[model samples]
Target: MDATVNACIGSDRLFDSPTTMNASVAIESEMKWISGMRPILSEEDFFTWMSLIIYVTLFVALIGIISNLLVIITCARIGFSETINISYLALGIADLMASATRFYGSIFLLFEITTTKVHFDPRTVSSVVAFLPSQGFEKTAAFITAFIALERCLCVQFPLHVKTIVTKRKTIFSNVIIYIFAFGPSNLIHMVYRFKWVYNATQNRTVLAIDQSETRLRYILARALYAYYGTILNFTALIVVWICTVYLVLGLKRKAVARKENFKTSFIKDNKQKDLQVIKTVFLLAVTYLVCSIPTAITLLVPQFVPEFGSTRALARISRVSYMISGLMMQVNSCTNFFIFLYMGSRFRKALITLFKRH
Candidate 1:
């Protein structure tokens, strides 16, 4: 999560300490040494503790990648022709890409801390490698989730019109638009605003400067733009998905009740049961997304308002650990859609079985 790096940056600004870079490098070297040979019991065994965290994060990310990939292949093999099926396939691919990005970020961080001597710098290393790709994929996943939720809500609320409205071509078009928006101009702005190497005349060298602007106000504005991109857009989509899920559930219940009372409903008749099943599946997906995302959002948002949260060493350490846990949860959410499909979508489960049997 960018929250981790952002928190560090925020902390650096608040302290206004010239030794911040040196302190960071010393900490990194100490951590590497601790993870290697000597075990330091001071400062709550920070290095040893963080090493455990890195290993655990790596394991979970690998599992996530494999699970998302399997879902993609299964969906493609079994569900090539249906519109909703194709959407699920697209969502699965998006999930796979997301997991891959996260997995790469995790490996890169480990490599930097374990192998590379240079201190971890968010400006140059994180921005280019982890920050942009992860955000792109995360936004893509969020938008596609909202897309699926909206499609299901419409199909349940107005079944007949939905078929005409949400054709294969239109669905594909919507996905392309999502991809474009997820990786478009705002992200380019982020790449430009994040970092630069500025000459320090006093130090007689170039130092990596992040979020530097001509004016403090402009710097704040730049950070706000990135923050909104990272948190707000995704949260808005989550809220929409939640609302759509609720409407869909109520609609499904009403129809089920009407059918029980022998009252015929004037809507699409052929796929009520199937549509209900899909609604159930999407409902689970929405809930999972909310559960996993809210923690990360909180982690990112709170520190912005309470800069003091990361001002102290102890607090910063705690924030780092919290960031890792929340990050893992987000990754799990991205990968576990496959399990949700297996649980709620009987068709998906049967398809998986058939796919394996064929092989």
Candidate 2:
């Protein structure tokens, strides 16, 4: 959802001196930034829509928090001796993190919206504190989803050897590395930009402003990293998921054809059915990830091609709507996985039932 905001914050023109900004006369508004400026909609209309969206996001985040917690608990109880369990467990954790952060950010925005007058800009504060971590969790989830897809593809491609090649220990190590890669850049950004109390002219009060405490070289590096995370990192993960998903689909189709052409014994038939069921679960997951990601990807990619299409540029207003759409989809994606697991993952379902019975 915030691939653009989270990834492009470092390179934003608004990163001038981190001095306190006048809420009304800030030199630059951030991408997907919350403001009273009218986009295609009039100011009142825009804010109404934004308010509705913020409320919806808050609802989704709450549901997601509960759902993902269940997924985590179920996965833990199910155990992770199997490599697939390890991936599922990691994915649950990542989605849980994403949902929690989204909830945190959404609550702040809701407060800002409802209050008649506010001293601090809750949306502005959330942009950094909640969005950055949310982005990291989203990115981490993307990588783990892609990893799940790729792992399944390998298993299908090399049935006998895959178990040995993709062991549980190896899966654990891979998830750890994915977490590091996804979160490292965002955390680095936290270090470079420190928040401080500064007088905001628009609010007529002191508020925490993001203060920069880095050298010129570090600033440039941060920009490059942000650009990479926003564009290249997401692009790579999306492409990988796409390719793996296609490969798995084709393999399944070919197997279907083979099954129709040849007769198998009951034992063989049962085993093949089990394999197909597993593939179906992964296929559903990959497709869900792919469909949900396209909107966010467009927001991230469009600015790269159209230099004028920035958070502070000519197309800023239109892009806010796009951001709203994309943000909602990503949140849906984060929360939606638990249901997927519940319906498709037999082991997970059993574990969840057992968990509920225990409680």
Candidate 3:
């Protein structure tokens, strides 16, 4: 979520800052400019709040990730024959990695704010450090959700085919694809631009800069490419998962009706239970994704209409709040999937309880 919001804001912010600075001289020459300009918020106040909130959220997420990992490891160590359990294990591992990455990234960002008193340079190493893993994990989490959707779809649509297709080998392969899809573009960008640190005498601080062409076209094209690539792919994956989820639900409903009408009482009871479980799991995940993602998407999409809303200070403030809320929500999404499973899935809850009892 932070990744999406940052990508949306960082690109445009970097693009516009130079122009705005250049325009400041013209405004200063004309006293009339002062009449329309709104007062800017103090940097200290902004940084203080941002640093506190990010660090606190990071700490909470760290604790949740650790607990989830313990449960996952315990479940894996104990004998487990069920295939879905293995998928949950994989999901837990992905969630843990995402949470750890977010925690460290947040800490680094908070430190950067306090120690350097410098703005994050989006074209440099600082930007990569701040944005890369967040984007990577954002994509990875989407892939994992899609994988889970695919698994559920298979169970409902092709029960016999699922046994052969949804194996440990396939799960590993899917994870590899997720990593490649998520990190490949950002890594490539990092390789192209070597980031260097420099001391800014005027600001009395260290700043990171990238060795790239100074042409406006180059920066515009680069950002456009990244925005196009990242948003399209991630959003597409999200849509795919939604479609798969809908199909799964419809299939389950059809099966339930068929079972009821066939006078197969035992089959109805068993199938109904499985159907309900799938519905619960899918619905929970879908709702979480919506709650976590929609605000970020709105923030991203809002800036694209800059000509329409950019001049409004209220809109700008709203965008900032939306970006922050989206970041918090995405972190929540990354850290809470395990708890969702624990709440909704009987097998996961039982396994967790048993593990805790043994400890």
Candidate 4:
């Protein structure tokens, strides 16, 4: 589940970067490990497959950029209100950033692979690769989803105090905090450790290599941090989202039933129905996030629990394929949220149309 696209990381020929003997040995060991694990494929065949994967991933990244940009624009046009539009706007902005970075990496990789004579700045490439995914926008998006769902739950349970408890000011402040926590620490360590200008013997030039240090403790701690923040925290947030969504839905249904029993056509009943629709729309978004995230989470977590799984070449290949599928699912989820809004949010759809007309 290595989503970052640095060439020097986990790559063979790119390791010509000068490093400590320990780092060099580690690089050699990785090369040997990859050689043993690589599935039997012709050079031409492997590149062809890689090309296809790169192209598809790039295409999805592009689509996500456009779609999320539209979502952000629409959110801005509609203005924030009580319907978790602020959360959607935050999510859209985060996804837009992630998609744009992914697009750059994919396009750069494609160009690098297709060209025989390499002419690129490794420092720039390594910096981008190390910094882009490290920004933790994905985790921010996940957190925002959970917050949105939890807010809905609170609204359903305490509609009378919803305004007091969940003010726009509070929401904005919380979002700022999320951005600070999500985007800062995860990337700071990566930015510090990943960039180094080293001589590549094969390329016969100085190239910047994004390589980890020989400090096993540092590597282990980084992985631990990643597991804690990227996987465990996200999983926790998702569980909260699921719980809140279920409670909110059941509460809404019960209220709707009570309203129906009291009167055939009451204002409260109409409002309840509309609220239910909005909740259901958000529930769809939560479900997509949950479903799409499972594969990536499993792929990331499985090896920790099942140490022998990666020992087998066949299992490793299966894991790689699973990761690719999960990555694609994530990309699709990011790209299609605007479409979901279009389908489920009447107000959002009208706002989108108005935005287009204004342009």
Residues 1-359 of candidate 1: C-alpha lDDT, one tens digit per residue: 22233223222221121101112322333233432333223344544555576577668768878888878888877755667777787777777776776676666555534533333443344444454456566667778888888888887777669879888999999988887877553355444455657664333566565544446654565456455555667667768877887887788877777545543454544355566677788888888887887777776677779764444443545555556566677777778898988888777788789888998
TM values, all candidates:
0.74, 0.84, 0.74, 0.80
lDDT of 3 at 55: 70
What is the Å distance of residue 268 in model 1 from its true position? 9.5
List RMSD in Å for every model shown: 7.7, 5.9, 6.6, 5.7
Name the runs in model 1 displaced over 4 angstroms.
1-42, 115-123, 185-225, 261-270
By lDDT, the best candidate is 2
Q: Weakest 10 consecutive residues, lDDT, candidate 3?
A: 17-26
Candidate 1 global Cα RMSD: 7.7
Model 3 alpha-carbon drift over 4 Å, by segment: 1-35, 39-52, 78-83, 112-126, 200-225, 228-230, 261-275, 306-317
**Per-residue lDDT of 1-359 in model 2, one digit per residue for the tens?**
22222222122332211111112111144434455544454445545666787788889989989998998888788887678888888998998888898787777656555542445556456656776677788889989999999998997788779989999888999999999998666666665666777775545688766664558865786566556566777788889999999999888877677765544588777766767777888888888988988887887767679754534523454455566667778888888888998888777888888888888
Over the full model, what C-alpha lDDT does candidate 2 score relative to the true structure?
A: 0.70
lDDT of 4 by residue, 1-359 (tens): 12122223222222211110001222233334544455444334434655676688779878999999999988888887664888889989988876776566556555545543355543245333522352366667777888888888887788678889998898988888888876655554443455567666545787665554556655565555555555676678668877876787788877776656755667867776777777888788888888877776676577689864434433433443444455556666678788889999888899988888887
Local lDDT at 272 for model 1: 59
Sorting all predicted structures by TM-score, with the top scorer first, yields: 2, 4, 1, 3
lDDT digits (tens) for residues 145-204 of candidate 3: 777777788877776587797887777677677767765554555544566676644346
What's the CA error at residue 165 for candidate 1, in Å? Answer: 2.1
Pitting candidate 2 against candidate 3, the one with the higher lDDT is 2
Model 4 is weakest, by summed lDDT over 10 consecutive residues, at 14-23
The lDDT of model 3 is 0.57
Candidate 3 at residue 180, lDDT?
78
Error of 3 at 335 (Å): 1.3
Best by TM-score: 2
**What local distance difference test score does each model get?**
0.62, 0.70, 0.57, 0.63
